[model samples]
Target: MQNLTQAIKHLIIINVIMFVAPMLLNMDLTNLFALHFPKNQHFGIWQYVTHMFMHGGFYHILFNMYALWAFGSPLEHMWGRNKFLFFYFSAGIGAGVIYTLVNYYQFNGIYDQLINLGVSAADIQNVLDTGSYNESIITLPNETMREFYSLYHTPAVGASGAIYGILVAFAMQFPNAKLALIFFPVPIAAKYFIPIMIAADLFFGVTKYSVGNIAHFAHIGGAVIGFLIAWYWRKNQFTFR
Candidate 1:
């Protein structure tokens, strides 16, 4: 590995810039980088790719970059720069598409439910188009109305899905590689870690559906796309070498 330097520098820099600059300036980089409605009044269409580069907080970016550097560099070396870049971007874009699917279900569901409860189409349109839920438009009982309003109001942002893709890649490629938890130092292979994490995401996603501000579905979406792409490569026996 003498000539093979860490190939994740650019990924690290992008994450750092996205995470640090925004927090330092007290700006919401997630909104700018996050993919919004096609006619999103908040951000441009370019945000689909830009959002993959942005992260929510220090821990968010740090863990992702760490995983990218840890597992992605090995894959890049095996796949070459061009191929690796292709996979990285493909996984990220795939994540965005899946997230959009989930958001569609959520936004439309909320809109329909609100309209049924006497909310106006104008207010529903605002939420669908801008990710905002108008409190004044809610006509249901107070507790249910408050809960409904909270569900569609906040923005979902991060690179965790794409990062989770990398984790999947790592698990598949090096199923035998032993990974140890720092705090709870049980040695488990990469293969075991990926599935366990996916299961936990699913459980939490279903069980805590009402809890505000978590994009558990997005995590599942990313993993599914990553698995499909990786499986195709493996099935075709296509090696970058």
Candidate 2:
């Protein structure tokens, strides 16, 4: 692997500090930085950007920081530091927006249904406040009720969305580049690997698979924005050198 570029190294350092600071201080940083439902009391405008730097666990940060160094350095080398940072944040913010929009869609479905079934706004607020709802007040099916209950309280965290954007940009810039997967132990070309990963996220997002704690739509959102930016740059023959 190539040595880390200045921007990628700085990002990794910042993320490490963010991850370690909360743990060392015995502080719960999730409520303050993780992206939350807009209606949630913890929701704040700053979280749109901050959430990109927050991770849920050690492995979470490990994978993301590794990807940032592995994939992002090349982009920074090609696009220069300023453009690279712009693309990174743009994709991240775009991911947050799209993730929120999708959450709103699913949330509204349950919200409208609950209202029609005579569930009160106060009761709904209780569920958001405390991830548990009174079954007596909610007439929806058990599964549907659980879905709504989880959606309102769960906050999205981590840099996976922006990392997905980086992966997309990497594939665009080096389609023929060969990459290997640890579990698969097979060297696959970037053109093949990247699309397959995106397709998997799409499938999981639409089907709501048992994949734990992943914001699939956020990955899609980042890729979508990243693709647009990459395509535009490629189309215009944009280059730093």
Candidate 3:
């Protein structure tokens, strides 16, 4: 495994600075880290880059930092600072793009369904205008309102997608690595563990089985991008071994 390098230090510093800048400048930095539904609402296209720096809170950054320390140090040392930085941002952006695409299709699907159901043209316009389902169907019953709320207002915040990408990278390069789930005595090989985790996310995303603001698709997006990246690298003659 590789050791922590300057790139990791630089990333940690940049993230901390961005996280603190919001408070210092009297602006909300939270939106910079988490992608919102309304395209025009964010700082700009640059938020896609800065968003990786802003985290929701302590535990949010904590988990990401820990994962970086665990999986990224090796990657950084192996790839060097410049390459590592490129890989990190690429995965981050890839996650964001894929997430938006999925949301777009689903939102359009709902809009089409509502149109067929004869929701007033005004109501449909409001939903599309504000990007909020609740705002769209204020006249609906309580049961329907519950469903609308589930559709929007759940902004995903965190660096887990990129971190999950790093996890996939590490698992691919070191399939024999022994890792234990939190509080579990058993150690699982990286090869088996990572795939199982990805499969679980896909299953849950498909079923919408869990009730929470988990960006399961984003996680899968990051992992898929990471896998593709590793594949591309190897095909072009880059290999950790």
Candidate 4:
């Protein structure tokens, strides 16, 4: 294993603490620290950053931190500590922003449709608050209701977004680097592997192909920001020093 770069080391430490502390203390920190819909009662401004350090489960944190150590360390070594930290947080926050905006678009569409169908704002608020609706009082299509319900109640947690950013930056800097995934088991150039991952996320996000709360759009958002930053720095001949 490679020795951790300074910023990456601190990040991994924070993430591990965030993951383990709640379990040891017997407190539920996910609801408070995890990113929630801006309109949700539990939503907090600080969660934009905090959510990046929070993970939902053992495998979630393990995968994210592994990616951080494996991919992020080289970038940190290249960009220097401060620049790397800036890039990490910027991509993470940008991901959250994009995710929220996408959710808003979907939520607004559903809200407008419900209102056109004569559903009251109060009824909508009640449904969002209680996670249930009186079907007799607000008769909408079951799928539509479910979508709205899921959007309002689901909280996004994990470092996947920032890790996606790191992955993109790594690919940009070392396009010819060989990467092999456990599932694919074939070594591919960084350029090829990264794009394939992003494309898969795009497909899954559009189709909702899987039933889990994977934030595919957030991953895309991070990749987009990471690419933009890396491209700009390259174009400007920016140096780590």
Candidate 5:
């Protein structure tokens, strides 16, 4: 592995601190830092950037920080600290925005269905706030209703989105680099591996087949933004340092 560049080192440090400090201080920063649904009372504008530093669990931070060190270090070395930081934050924020938009589409779809079923706007809002509804009144499938409830109540945390951006950038820079995953132990070139990863995210995102509380759309958003920026920079022969 390459030595950690200045930006990657500091980012990992900050993420570790954000993850550890709350536990040490006996504080819950999720309401303040994690990205919440726009209509959620806990939602804040600053969460788009802060959520990149907040993590949900030990393995989450471990994988993200490791990816930052492994993939982001090389990009930082190539692009210099300032450029790398810009790309990282841009992709992170873009991921948050895209994630929110997708959620809005899903949320509104269910909301409209309820309204068309003669449910009032206030009652719908009440369902979101209280997580209780007149099951007799809400005839939508239980799974769809549960998804709507989850989308409104759950907040997104972790650096996975930004790490995905770094992964895309790294692949573009080192297309022939061999990469492998734990489950799929066979090594494959970055050019082939990264797209497959993004495709998996997209498939799971659209099909709702993902296990756990994974934000698959956020991964896709990061990959899209990363590819656009990296492609533009390469095409225009742009260099920051």
Candidate 6:
């Protein structure tokens, strides 16, 4: 196991404190720190960065912190603290923006459909605010309406997006490195393993077949942003260390 690099060590500490402090204080910081929809009342600009440090549960934080230490440490070591920190925050902020844009696309699609069906702006806002809509007045599918409501109400919290960025950077740095998943113990090269993971997120994001309250687009966004920046750096032979 590699020793935790400076940036990764500090990041893990901050994430742990964010995760634990709320519980200890019996404080619900979700509204303040978690990433909410742009139209949501609790939405804040800072959430783009803060949400990366907030996690949903024990396993959520565990996996994210472990991945940060495992994948990010090497990147930090190679790029130095300043460059790695910049890339990390850039990818994370990019993830949040992409996630929001995708949600807005879906939400607006449904919203336009409702408007075409004679739903008024007031009624739509009411529905978003209260999660209540008169069935007789709106003939949209239950699943579609449910998704619309959820898009507005659900808040995203986790470092998975940023961790995904690190994973992409790691794979680019060491394509031939062996990697394995807890479920699939067979070791696979990072090049193959990383793409498969990103593909899985894309599939789940598009199909909405994900089992949990996962922000798959955020993962894909992080990977996409990470790839772009990493590719640019490599193409230019950029090195900070």
**Model 2 misplaced stretches (Cα beyond 4 Å):** 132-137, 239-241
> What's the C-alpha lDDT at position 119 in model 2?
77
Model 4 Cα lDDT, one tens digit per residue, 1-241: 6678889889999999998989999989877999999888899999999999888889999999999999998888888998898899999998998999999899999999878878889978988777787787677788888889888888899888888988999999999999998898999999999999999999999888956879998999889988888898889978664
Cα lDDT of model 6 by residue, 1-241, tens digit? 8888888889999999999999999999999999999999999999999999999999999999988888898889889998899899989999999999999999999999999999999999999888888899999999999999999999999988788888999999999999998899999999999999999999999988999999999999999999999999989988775
Residue-level lDDT of model 3, residues 1-241, one tens digit each, is 4455787877777777766777789897565555765432543566566567777777778778778778999888787777777778788878877876787677656656677777876876666456465534454455444444344444566667787788898998899999888877599999999999899999988887856667788789888888888778867966442
Give the runs in model 6 whose Cα sits over 4 Å from its true position: none
The CA lDDT at 239 in model 5 is: 81
Q: Find the 10 residues in a row with the least total lDDT in model 3.
A: 144-153
lDDT of each: 0.70, 0.89, 0.73, 0.89, 0.92, 0.93
Residue 19 Cα positional deviation in candidate 6, in Å, after optimal superposition:
0.4
**Ten contiguous residues minimizing lDDT sum, candidate 6:** 232-241
What's model 1's lDDT at 178?
82
Which lDDT tens digits does candidate 5 get at residues 96-214?
A: 99999999999999999998999999998898888888889899998998999999989999878888888999999999999999998999999999999999999999998999999
Off by over 4 Å in 1: 1-7, 23-28, 37-40, 123-153, 209-212
Q: Candidate 4 has what TM-score? A: 0.96
* Clashes per candidate, residues 3 or more apart or on different chains: 1, 0, 0, 0, 0, 0
Residue 32 alpha-carbon offset, candidate 6, angstroms: 1.0
Off by over 4 Å in 4: 136-139
Give a tens-digit lDDT track for model 1, residues 5-96.
Answer: 34467777767877788778988665566766543456566776787787666777777777787778877877777667677777777777
